[model samples]
Target: MARATGIRGIWHSLPLERYTSRDNYIWLVVATVCIGAFMAAVDASIVNVALPDLSTYFHASASLVSWVLIAYLLTLATLLTLFGRLADMMGRRPLYTFGFLVFIIGSAACGAAINLPMLIVSRVFQAAGAAMLQANSVAIITATVPASVRGRAIGFQGSAQAIGLSLGPAIGGGLIGLFGWRAIFYVNVPVGLIGTLMAAAILPKDKLSGHKTTFDWWGTALMTPFLVLLMMALTEGNSWGWTSPTILGMFAASGLLLVGFIFRELSFRAPLVDMRLFKIWVFSVGNFTGLLSYLAMFGVLFLMPFFFERVLTFNSAVTGLILTAVPLGMTVAAPKAGAMADRYGPRLLTTSGMALTGLASLLLAWTLSLHPSVVMMVIELVLVGVGLGVFTPPNNSSVMGSLPSSRLGVGGGILNMARSLGMAMGTALSGTIMAVVLIAHGGVEKAGGPKGPWIPSTRYSLYVLVALSLLAALLSLFRVAEKDSSKHESMPLEW
Candidate 1:
């Protein structure tokens, strides 16, 4: 009886009555969620800029220091589904608020790290918190906002992410230059604290699926090993050699684990992920295309800095400034694309966006030179960004729309997992291709100047990325079907 009373009191604290007008309340929720979205996005990208400085400080090999990045990404990717399931079983409000606290603590720990291992450990904690935040970001938005403007709300969230991403290089570079690499991690503490407070005060209480469901421990057990092994294989493939015994063994092990996970999910009474969700063609196709879109985007992001600094002889600062075009384009296009997706179906916009991105990549592959013009590079990146901007919100909305409210947490978790997987794959694949091609061009290691095998190898990698982008476009155009826009409309009782 006391437990029931405590639940009631916490529910009452939601303040829905205070914001009796639904429209005002909806925007407030968006405002609150955007804070977390922006901060998480910023942190993910900011660390890249600080990596070299960190390597110098720790006096570590590039491969070892890379664990700083790999550890965070690997932990975040593997745990996203688990946390999403927990959010449904528990409550998003408390979990989200707790995530902020955990993230703040992790950030402080990262900042205070005495060595690389300590920093890597802190990053693991940071990624766990990030998984909690990301797994529910879409689910919470889907629950609160009216379906009529759901796309727009999601668009604004995407814009917030773009804003965060755009600022990361600038903020990260400045912080590192001014204070040190530690300052980059320290910046999150204050921002995370504010977000935590706002989440506690402003976010509405989540209604636990109006029914009790057992947590899928068996499925989670299978999934954890599957994802970790797969991500490790992908991340280490460049250094380990694709055909090396260790890399091959990891891949084979991941495949077996994946098979086990699929079997468990299908057989389990309370599966962490409902295998049937993939049978919804829209959900499945949207997710696949979404993964491909991110793969293409991050492929360019990973490769371009090399192109800028090594080939074009630009400094890191200039390269950082130039990269802003991508996110800026995303910020500009996302909201408009969201609004458009609401009117026309997502099929046209998504297909067109992926097609455009492929064309942009092809253009870069064909036209890029040893001394590529800054204007041309910016235009290409902006086009890629715009394509992603147009594709993501609608794609995400469609995935979330296909699921019942009860399954939104798991569905969103799956969607985010695709994204994280895509990012890792893109970076790994492009990096691998470049490394192989450069190695084949024997003079690359000796040539500090741009004239060696690196330039052609970079171009060839872009060619491969173009193919991947076009393949994604084909999938979007052919596989994804037109769904009822009304499917996204707000249901009063669900909220």
Candidate 2:
């Protein structure tokens, strides 16, 4: 049946009670998921301005102090697949609820920490919860929605996340100014408590039995250590040099370990991650590009504030306003892109969106002379933002649309897991490259960091960002697959 006909049936054919009941339930569920998502995303951006404050509190070196953030990101990265698989086994509600509680405790602990090590330990707890929440949010949404409107549901989820992210920096900056860095962590506790309460009330209490969930424990065990070590190597390797015994040793271990994990998954009866999914070019290519997109996007994110504040000499408020260009562009363009993709196809949009991002990155890199018109720079960043807005939904729709409905949970899990891993790698890669290049070019002394002769590394980092964007564009080209026609109108290339 055609989508219009199908939608009409769903709306008009069903009794009013059916539609009303579902709407009430879905709205509550969406609210619960948004709470969880906001918690995760808010923290992700909130800490951007707090690193300096943390260093003073710990009386630690700036480089050492940075580990607080790095550790959290690495822990989040290493555990996404683990918890995502667990969500597949246990159920989203239990994991999601537990995540909020864990996050709350972690935040409280962070606010009270006495030193760097203690704070870092608390960060790990926070990360564990974030990983659980982040991995399951989309899976739950996808599982709950009907096939015909899955794209709209996913798009809404993405929009919520993007909105939350856009708010984070502003919230973080405002709190730090009013209270302190401790306030950043303190803020999560009350919000989390309310969310937890609402979720427990609104969510239904039923779960699918994962009779064979443990079938692929070997893959889990292998992938976890591989990512943990790999991110460690990437984030620290440049400072240590990739060829250093420590770096090379970790790299070798990660490679060997992941290879074994892949082989095990392929042979396992109930794989943790289905290796055969790769046989479908759409899933395979979509996953591949998803990783690269984060690599570029987060690299820009990791550095842009620094560029705005340190390089351009803007204050926190101005820096945030400038940074808003990225999300703002996405906000304005995404709905239109989704509408367009509904008419044509996702192929061109996916490919062109990435191409635009690469072009934007190139423009950004070329203009990093610290004297470019701020307005022009913001506009360029907006272009990259719009490109991402265009890319995410259609691509997500295509990938999910092509898969069987039963696998939406695992498939969603995998896609998000890939995204989290990409973010972790991007954070580490961008950090390491900036640190290494700055040290090589002018040393910490020349970099003139915002705080007293600090390392001004954001300029060099733009190169890394540009390179990652170019690579993302290349990967985006491989995600050309058609959605199931039975589901909706064929999406356009630009959409």
Candidate 3:
């Protein structure tokens, strides 16, 4: 009893609010949040490079081993909004801190796993923790930071994520080569522990609402299954056959659940997601464009590995190194773009960014047949990265800025959910399109494996991505002006 009381006292005393001024303290919060962002993003991609190793180690089939990745994504996508709602009701500090702890434990479990199922389940657990961190990282920043610097703060977080994602493959490859696949999971342990302690020490206390609200169990129940089913269909549509009864049933069921979730949120007193938030043009259009941006970005990312390995005949190491150019460009540009957005509105930056990305995609497609020089290829990818870097932070700031402070949590949740959905959809659609194009040219067996129709199929996929990028650019043009978002800021919160 005495020990437990002492631990509680220590926890309470950990907050650094007494030592730091408001101005200085917010940046510390941003830095701490960046750790979570970095760790979560790193985990998302790091596991990819380890999948073949995992298969060999566990003696599992490719399909079964893939669940290790899929389960994490599925769980993360399904629970993001729910956890975001919980953060609003409970407190961001507690949820975010506990997220680090959960992630640490999950990482340890993954490292110590005896079999594939254990590792997969551990990944699901890790993703739950990641969902908590991601859902609140933006909300906490918005709630704590001044509007003037909010874009810059979010930009830092975006850069951390991009850097982590960019480095994951290289890091995973090195770690696995030196220490084996388990090292990838174990690496998270120390980082997560430090992040957990930092969060407890520096994060501001959550400001609880004055009034009590009921938890939206029905909304959660409906939304979770809906997302799970929807993501499953998207992730496995190609493998399962898009027209298969099982895929069709999952899609149909997900659609029904989505309708039910919408109806429930509209009618319920305290909804999981405030459906009315979408009524704000910035919030709605920002989210839509954000989804398209990721779709376009990830579609290119999904296709590039195939292009590098099969068409260019590059080794994995060379491909990974070349791919780093995209995120490197993003890392360089995101902070500057974010700062620019604060001075000038997101409209010009976002529109220009997507236009740049579309133009890059168009160039890549146009140059594919010409066999563009490696330098040219890297430059084009870097431009795409720069475009995404410029677009994300300002767009995120705009979406969060448009919301009442109270709705920031769920708002962030929806924003992240859109990103996850976009990634899943991007990979699925691009792969499906490439396969279809290949089939149209000749069967896969006859197409001669990456040498035959693959280049043309890839070019067609890039054209599709270019179209999506243009559409996102068009949508960005419609974003409500910054001043207009402020008008809606004080709207009463239904929850």
Candidate 4:
């Protein structure tokens, strides 16, 4: 039977004519993606501020309350590649629109939760939506926009994400102060609704390559357990004792699962992640550098609140406001960096950015004080943000631009996974290092007063970040050689 070629078919055939002008439509896609990016970034940080309130409300221990964050991050981290693959198969438009709806529903449920379990469950669903949105955000932009402006578009998105993350604590604190912790979740409902409608209306339809698509069930099955166990071990190692039986068991299990996953991917015709992508020097280096960037970024983010609150005697509100300098600097620098990357290649910009970041880390370590000057703190943070801001756009552009359109979704997914993994590692590493150092000094209490004890640990962690940043800078310098870098030059959009 012949299918009726009705309104749906016509709509698909004449997409651009039906919508706004091509340039406007491209910007619309960028705007829609930025909204989703902002929401994801905001949610990632906003919940941290609300954790104490939730702990008080639920009368739960700190360890249990911590799962609220862990569950969401774990779910998000593991499923990013899965969702990105699905976006390629099923079409990014539908997946992205559905993600917004799912996020809205999850946010509402979280706001209405009656217990910690319910809240945690809602967060898992929230993360699922987040994975969907993040997985497709870059792929969609790369597909829709012209190559010339792609860096600029990606940079704007980065700025939006940074702004959301940087402002989250302030927003969360204010909402919790006035309306309670529930308001933190409820706040996303309206924004999510708007994003959903915008995505549905404006996103370009997926141009499937007519290649036969197949799912790598075996690969996915092995991969999921590997990630879960590995992340659990990393996240819980500090509290659970790194050498404890449970941690050892998780490491062993994860190692075995990773081996199985590697075998499965090697044999499978359509692997969940095409491991061959790593063979491309640009792709591999870009992802690694990105991981280092986030590792440093989140390490700083995780440690700074403690510095402000305990060392400087600042309140939550003050700490959040002070933290805003980081993203403010990012927002200011990112777009210009992107445009510069478009004019020149990413090599110089990214290398310089990482070098600046390393310098800032060293400066912060030297300047760190029990009672630090506010001006100095702000200067260090702004420098870090600016460095990251300069590094992000060009690096992302190179990664996304390196792959063919067929692999863009997966490439973006892998890129995002690196970021999430870096964040998880950063938080865990920073906390664990500080705790160990503080303990070595006979605990925070025995060393001196609150600020006095923490300063050493903090200084040591910054030194670690300086090393990471320098390594990243070294990697960026080799990302592409000057003569052979013509491949990164802008070309016409295929999608």
Candidate 5:
């Protein structure tokens, strides 16, 4: 099939293909990738509800309970850059296939966990699999599809993830209510098996790069300890005291390792991540802006459910239903925003989206005094949902389009890695802040009783999120070209 063409005559942002006997199987690939992406995204949301269940199951302290989440996030964070490098070394197909298998194993272990430590360990394994899948899916799709249709393909793929994430609470709550917490883990088994089989059949086999690259063993070595230490410090610092030897040591070591990793990447021949990608104005600004934006967006998601159930006095099911607006709005708006970015440019859509996102954050902050009304909450959340729907696709397009085709594999990997880090940092940071604030306010008793301190803590967190969103808007403004500038001006990706 002759590929579709757009005005600039360079083809659309990505490739396209006509369905053929040989190509009928492409849908299988789409299904496979989408399923994996959806699973990873949904798990993030699903587990939020399961934490209490897990806490009870293990009879652990709040600090230990929190590690159930922190451990998974830290592991995923530590592995993403490494996994991206590994995919560059090994074929994406094999790595992608193996990811699903690993995920299945992790899920089973989680379902059958005998103790809290075991569950956290299982989650670590699951996170490893998730990183592998996330870093490779976009690269795989870009490789298989013609660029003419790439935006649509990626848009739909992202949409699946959005829907899955939106529905996660509903699914997890429903499964947990009916069957038990174990159902959440068991749910992934069939999907993992199917996705594994399809990926093996559709994705072409290829060998790891034979070029004698060393994989930046030093970069990988330092990064893990850096993230683990940082997250551990953040999670435990309040309990241990910021000045406590343990917290101070972790903080100090994390700083040293991070600085060491940065110097190592800049000096390495083939760095684990191409540090030079930071030099591209769009790539740099877009990623930082997006990261901060995710910090706010997911911070809200992580904290809101607690507010809904405890302060506002709603049930878990209702919280899930109300939160549904975010994903729903994203599902509605992403493709349209993507299409507009395709026609107009990423500048308007992304900046405007983020600006609106800031507005939503402000709305929540403004309304903190009032009791949570489902209607008001839904409306504010809808704005957030719409803003995210608008912001993500265009920003993603700009970042991904800025790269050359050859680098798509690694570039896509790095992009997702940044997102994962932001997500982990967001939830962990907010959780830690919420805990500290509540304790400081009146030793957790003033916040609330058995209900929760969600109102006070969430309100404070929203203020922080609002500031972050505004910063994101400013970053987007700086990065995106003015309407009069030539956005498509040829620039080498060799920076």
Candidate 6:
């Protein structure tokens, strides 16, 4: 007990903050937050690359093994809002610090899993930890950083996430090849520990409101099941048959729950989500366009792997390398775009970014028919990345900037929830479109197996993405122009 007390004292007494000036200190906080962002993003994609090895090792069917990914997604999606609100009510520092500890423990558990069920369960635990981290990251940035450089700080965090996501496949494949599938999970342990310490040491102390507020337990109950049901239905609709009773029931139930949740929030004293935040033009439109932006981005990501492997006949390594071009472009563009948004308003940058992405997607569709060279393909993908990178930071800055400091947590949660929904929708939509296209063309077997159907299916899917991007660009124009950062800082939320 004495040793424990002594260690705790030492932990609390670390004078890390004294080393940096105020301006530099905020960037340090941003850097610390990026660790969580990077780790969570990495795990999301890393497990995917090792799915085949996991199936073989466990002697599980592909359908059964997919739950490893599905379980993580469902769990992460369900808890983000809850934890985000908790950060508001409780405090971000403790929640974020604890999140790191939980993530580390979950990573270790995942690495040590001996059976398929065990692995799936461990993934759920890991995702919960990830939810905690993600829920608080943007809120922390919003509260700590100066408004002048907010976009740039958010851009760095986004860049970290993009880089982590981009590297996941390469890292997972290399780790699996060198030390088997477990290595991918094991890799998080050391990094997570460093993040934990950094978070504890560097993060600003949370400022708690003096008045006690009730947690919207009823709101959470309704919202949680609504999201789970909605996500399950969206993800499984194709496999379960779109019109099947099971899928229909899930969708119906989810819709009713959503309505109930909306009603509950409107009536509650302290709602889970402040319903009035939507009244702000920037908040509502930003989220809508944010969803569309990710929908287009992930749609392309989902379709490209199939196109690369089947149509282009590329190996997994080469496909992974080529795919990195998208995120590589994002990494390069996000910081600069963010800094630009900080100077000029988000309207022009966001609108131009999505327009660029729409043009790039159209070009990709055209290139698909031309049997384009590898260099041309990579260049096109990079252009798409640059567009998204440019769009995301500024858009996220606008959405987050529009919120009051008191509501930043829930706002950030809603922002991330939109992103998750967009990704799920993108994957489902792209796959469904491809399947339908192939079906119309007499199916894959009838259309000369893998090669023939893939090109047309992928081309059509890219066309849909182009439309989505253009629509997002149109929506970007609707946002009320911000003459200065002070406008967002004092933006009124109609109650």
Predictions in order: lDDT? 0.75, 0.72, 0.80, 0.78, 0.74, 0.79
Worst 10 contiguous positions by lDDT, candidate 5: 11-20
Q: Write the per-residue lDDT of candidate 6 for residues 150-173, one digit (tens) a residue.
A: 978987887788889888766765
Clashing pairs in 4: none
| Candidate order (TM-score) | 5, 2, 1, 3, 4, 6
lDDT of 2 by residue, 355-439 (tens): 7887887787767764677778888889988988888777777777767655665677678767777766766777777667666
- Model 5 deviation from the true structure expressed as Cα RMSD, one decimal place: 7.9
**Candidate 5's residue-wise lDDT over 112-213, tens digit each?**
988888888999999889888887787778777778888778767877788788898888777877788889999999989988866766665454557643
Segments in model 5 whose C-alpha atoms lie over 4 Å from true places: 1-23, 55-64, 146-151, 207-213, 342-344, 368-370, 404-406, 443-452, 482-495
Q: After superposition, which runs of candidate 6 have C-alpha atoms over 4 Å from their true positions?
A: 1-31, 47-74, 109-121, 138-159, 176-182, 200-210, 310-313, 339-344, 369-372, 401-409, 435-449, 482-495
User: What TM-score, to 2 decimals, does candidate 6 have?
Assistant: 0.81
Clash count, candidate 1: 1
Across residues 369-474, which tens digit of lDDT does each residue of candidate 3 receive?
4255888888998999899889988998899888876676678778888887676566566766776676577535121244657678889989999999999999
Task: Say which prediction, candidate 2 or candidate 4, comes out ahead on TM-score.
Answer: 2
Ranking by lDDT, best first? 3, 6, 4, 1, 5, 2
Q: Which candidate model has the greater TM-score, 4 or 5? A: 5
Best by lDDT: 3
lDDT of 3: 0.80
Please give, for residues 200-266, the per-residue lDDT of candidate 1 as tens digits: 7778878887566577787767777776676667656766788999989999998998899889877
Q: Tell me which of candidates 2 and 5 scores higher on TM-score.
A: 5
Model 6 residue 349 CA deviation (Å) reads 2.7
